[model samples]
Target: MLKTALFGLAAATQAIALATIQAKGSKLFTSDGNQFYIKGIAYQLTEDDPLAQGDQCKLDATLMKTLGANSIRVYHVDPTADHDACMSAFSDAGIYAWIDVDTFSTYILPDNPEWNETMYDAYASVIDAFHNYDNVAGFYVGNEVLTTGASSIAAPYVKAAARDMKAYRDSKGYRSIPVGYSAADIADLRPNLQNYLACGSNSSESLDFFALNAYEWCGQSDFETSGYTFLQQNASDYNIPIYFSETGCNTPKPRTFDDQAAILGSDMADSWSGAIIYEWIQEANDYGLISYGPSAAATATNAVGGYTRSGTPTPISPDFDNLSNHWKTLTPSGVSMSAYNPSASAPSCPAFTSGNWLVSGNVPLPTLGDAFKASGSSSGSSSGTSSGTVSASPSSSRAGTGGSSASAAPSSTGEAAAATSSAAAMRNGVPVIAQWAVWLGGR
Candidate 1:
């Protein structure tokens, strides 16, 4: 029998074909081939249960529409639930969704970063659950995995999972659903990470897009003053689309959301796709653009990670009003994929710069770990072939001709082992992200 999600998709597709967004150069395009920009908010719920919040989602959809939100990014979802009603609410309100596949229990933490079949299966389930929904914009392969320079070793495994998932989608004949990563604001290594992910033409190995969870811009800041100029300059030559997966600084209690003007304005439009505000509901960290009120406190225990709420839902913070007012006059650009140069080669891979940890920019990344092989081979699974045939560099092409795709499997003789790196311990210089860990846990 068709599942609720599949049935709803079939019905919805027939009634009104929604545009599935695709990455094109530094921008995004829709099914009708129109250009689109994200004016979204990061949203989960005061109550953590995605399956049971259909009614609540519907209610929130109305508020989001009122705030002029065109999209929402959800950190996690229950694959087993019937999300038709909630998804429908968002769709009806003309809102799109970009979702995360990993959660706290089943995540690729830096301390013990290992990508195996178990992880693959869980991620695949997320794709399976949401692939049918037209309004579902994309999937985040991993959120802020490379939170520090030492975490660079996990890059290959994360890239491997992305390669495999894209292949699975292709195998099932799905559209070009953008699969990307959400990076933390580790300025020192941000450029290298972005360049590395987009270094190869083997589309399977490269992320379709890239996002940054940035909080640099606070009250009353401009492009140059806020360090956005540097970000713009650094990404000037990048081949893939990039945007703020999460933004909206929260230094002052009532965030004015002043960054919205510059983010949605003409200054950074060409270089950036757009932005998704940090959050919807207030949490202990207080980054929310809106407050659900103290009555929603009962759900706070499950909503946020670190801080416990003692008071009733505070009145909608002034940030929401500022955000709403700003969005009222904001006019996003139309979708255009024409500038996309399909023949353009990807950026050359960065040389392994010896940061506090070793980094390998080699392409045809290490094969699917031995643990994930269907045949139980000690090597990568044969099913994990890259979509593009070309290698990112001449040396990479000549270097033992690794995997079937650009993600070459390690040679039996250890000839191509240099292409792989080992995980590093979480030592000093690793940013203190207790709040981030807690927030991700609940999501």
Candidate 2:
């Protein structure tokens, strides 16, 4: 009887562990083959390692679960900190994490972008830190890196970062964690920037997924009027998973979140995966669904210009209830991985215009070391000279209901080894702890 009881408890623990999310063509799926939609919130408290606060994470995870959220997007974390407690807390609550690999100092700057060794080491260290966790959904290479037409010159470097990161993930014998980018919703940069990042003939060079930080749908707006119709139509033929990395515009007094219906509803679910709300806390930007500290102390300000509060998470009344209500009613059941077949062809690389897209469609992406190679070309020894066009194939017919048609890639077979001590950890010729100190001051 004692042995049976212990085995049952262990089985229950394993049952609750979050499954790995995989990108199938333009949609996302769970390891069990069920289609997955991200009902997520953007969670970042400090500019540094937010996940390092395990006690706070435990408290917030319970509140998020009550809010009906299944995922959280964390913008930054200390690669060297122990995340077992927080990650385990979220996983036990059936929540997954979509983390950003680049830190504030390591991110590629538009004015002076370069995919060098320093950036590569920083990104690789983060991956090494979190890749073992089953609850990690994916990693964003850079967020809003290219906002304007002139800044579009940095496109190639961004692509190179994705390429090298994917390569490092593969070479380390780690699971095939998806690597992607998040773009600012700029009218002129749309479709072009999206196409450029996923355009390369080489599958290795193309982003595993793409995301956009959109806020066009303000309070009390419908799908067609909010410009989401145009956004969906443009993404109808995209070949990889795409979603709203950051959303929820807070202009009017109280937000209604009407766009939530259109996003997870039949209108856009076929073309898009899901969305993550702009924020969790009421900061200076004022998009939080909840605030921290006592209700009377909500007015207190912090040194960084955000609301100053700590302790229990206090939901900001109607805003919290509004989002919770939408999530409760709108449950989208996407198609099963077995039934779906991906037919969207790779989009043709966008042509360059003087000020709009500075890089020519034919120009090779910037390369790092001898790791990157164009789809149909040889290995790259130098930078920006690799060449080849990934030929476009026939397009598939759009589905009326459920997820769009797309074939699922084989699930990752790599198993994580036991965690090693920081002193002994080494990857790509750099000690993991040494890299952490250089980039994050050993946070």
Best by TM-score: 2
Per-residue accuracy of model 1 over 115-191 as CA lDDT, tens digit each: 55556777888888888778889988876666555566556656777888888888888777899887766777677
TM-score of candidate 1 against the unseen true structure = 0.76
lDDT of 1 at 411: 13
TM-score versus the correct structure, for each prediction? 0.76, 0.79
User: Against the unseen true structure, what C-alpha lDDT does each candidate score?
Assistant: 0.63, 0.70
Candidate 2 is scored at a TM of 0.79
Residue pairs in clash, model 2 = 341-405, 341-406, 342-406, 342-407
Candidate 2: where are CA atoms >4 Å away? 1-16, 294-306, 369-443
Q: Candidate 1 — worst ten consecutive residues by lDDT sum?
A: 433-442
- Which stretches of candidate 1 lie above 4 Å from their native place? 1-16, 46-52, 295-315, 338-344, 370-443
